[model samples]
Target: MPAWSSEMGAAMQVQIDKIFKEAAMQENIDDDAVFQEGDGVLAHLKFSFTLSDPGLKDCPLIGCSDGFSELTGYTMEEIIGRNCRFLVDPVPQEHVENSARMVAREFCIAVKDGEMYTVPDAHREPWMPIVHRDDGIFCIQTNARKDACLFKNLFHLKKIELDEKVYIVGLQTEMPIELWDEDQPEEKRQDACRAACRACHKNMGAAEQVMAKHFWFSSPMRRQEDGNDEDDGFV
Candidate 1:
C-alpha cells in the first residue's frame, strides 16, 4: 500500500468529508445522490434502482460516499449519469483486462485474478470484486471483507486513503458567521466581533474600499516566541 505524509492525508480528508456529505444528501433524499453506505467502507456501494421499472437509466443516482470520488478523482458533478467504466483505464495490461471486463459486464468476479482495474487517476490496480447482481439493475456487494485474505487488497488501502481524505475537508470549509458559538465567557472568548468592527472602521474609510472585504476581521498570527515564553517559568 502507498503511504502518504500526514499533511497530505489531513488535507485530503477534508475534501472527502464534503464529498460524503453531498453524496448523502443527493442519494437518499431526492435522488440527487449516487451512492450510500450499506456498511463499513468496503461494504459501501453504488446502487441504481429504476423508477419506471424499465432499465438502469430510469434509476436516478441518489448518493455515494467520499471514497467514490477519492478513488476516481472526480466530484459527484462529473460522476453522475456516467457509466461505471469511466473509472477504468481504456488501455490496460493482460492481468487487468479480465477484471475490467468483469466490471464492465457487471458480473460477480473475484479480484485475486492477475488483472488490474484502473481507478481513474488514482491507480491502475486490480478491481476489488464481490457478488454483482445485474438481473434487474446494477448492484455490487463487495465480498472481500477485511477478514477475507485476498492476494492484493487494493480496496483496503484505497478506502483508508478516502477516509483520511474526508477527514481533511474540515480545514477547507467555513460556517456562517452567526453559527459560531456565542456562549464563551468574556475571559475565554477572543473578541472577533471587536476586531472585525475595528477593521471595518479602519479599512472601510480607506481609498481602496474594494479590498475591505478581504481584510475584515482577519485573525492575527500568534508568534511562536510568545507561546514559548508563556510556557517557560520566570527567570
Candidate 2:
C-alpha cells in the first residue's frame, strides 16, 4: 500500500505538473509528464521547440542533482532566467550569436571553431555537435579537449592556466583493464585472442579533471594575467 493519501498524491502531482507545464508553455515545449512516489515526485520534461535563446527567464525549472552549480561556480538562481551563454566568455559572444542564427534554420553544423567544445571524460576526443533546434538555432557542443577541434589521440599536449595555476593538459594512452571470471577457467573462444580485454581509458588527475568535458564554464585563466595569477587564489 502507498503511504501517502490520494489527496496528497494529487497535490504533489499538481505541483510537478504546474512547473513543467509552465516551462513548456512559456519556453520551447508542448507536453510533459509528472510522476509521483511517496512524498516526492519527479518530472521529466521535453521542450518541443528549439530555444534560440536558452535563458533563465525562459526556463526556471531546474535541479542541483550533480552539483553543476558548484562546478560552474554559479548558483541555481543566477543560472535561471539567463541564457546558458553566460558559460561562455564575453569575447566569444559573436560565435554564440552566429550559432543561434544557424539553429533558426534547423541546419546541423560541425565547424572546427576553436571556441565551443566539450570533453565528456575530460580526455580522448571531444564531441562537438552542430546544433539545429526545432525552434531554429545552430549551436555546437563538444566534450573532449579545449576550444581546439582536436583530440588527445591526434594532437599534442597543451597548456592551460586556471585560477592563476598553470597546468598542462594532454593526451596519454593507458591500457584498459577488464574483470575476468575466476570461478571458471579461461577458454579460447572463436573471436577471442586474449582472455583480458584491453581498450582506451580516459583519465584526469587532480586539477585537470576539475572541469567537465562538454559544457561551458568560466575559467579563472580567461582573464587573469600570468604574473598576477598568484593573487587570485583560485583552485
Q: Cα RMSD for candidate 1? A: 23.3
Q: lDDT for every model?
A: 0.26, 0.25
TM-score against native, each model: 0.24, 0.21
Worst 10 residues of 2 by lDDT: 193-202
Candidate 2 per-residue lDDT, tens place, 1-235, comes to 1222323323333333343344334542112121222221122221111011212233222222112333334544554334333444332333343433323122212111122222223221222222222111112221122232211111112233444432223222111111123543233110111110100011112113222211113454332323332321212
Q: Which 10 consecutive positions of candidate 1 have the poorest summed lDDT? A: 166-175
**Any idea how many clashes model 1 has?**
29
- Model 2 segments beyond 4 Å from truth? 1-57, 89-91, 94-97, 100-235
Per-residue lDDT of candidate 1, residues 45-158 (tens digit): 221110010123422222333344444445655545444434333323432445434543422111122223333322223222221221111111121112232111122111
Per-residue error for 222 in candidate 2, Å, reads 43
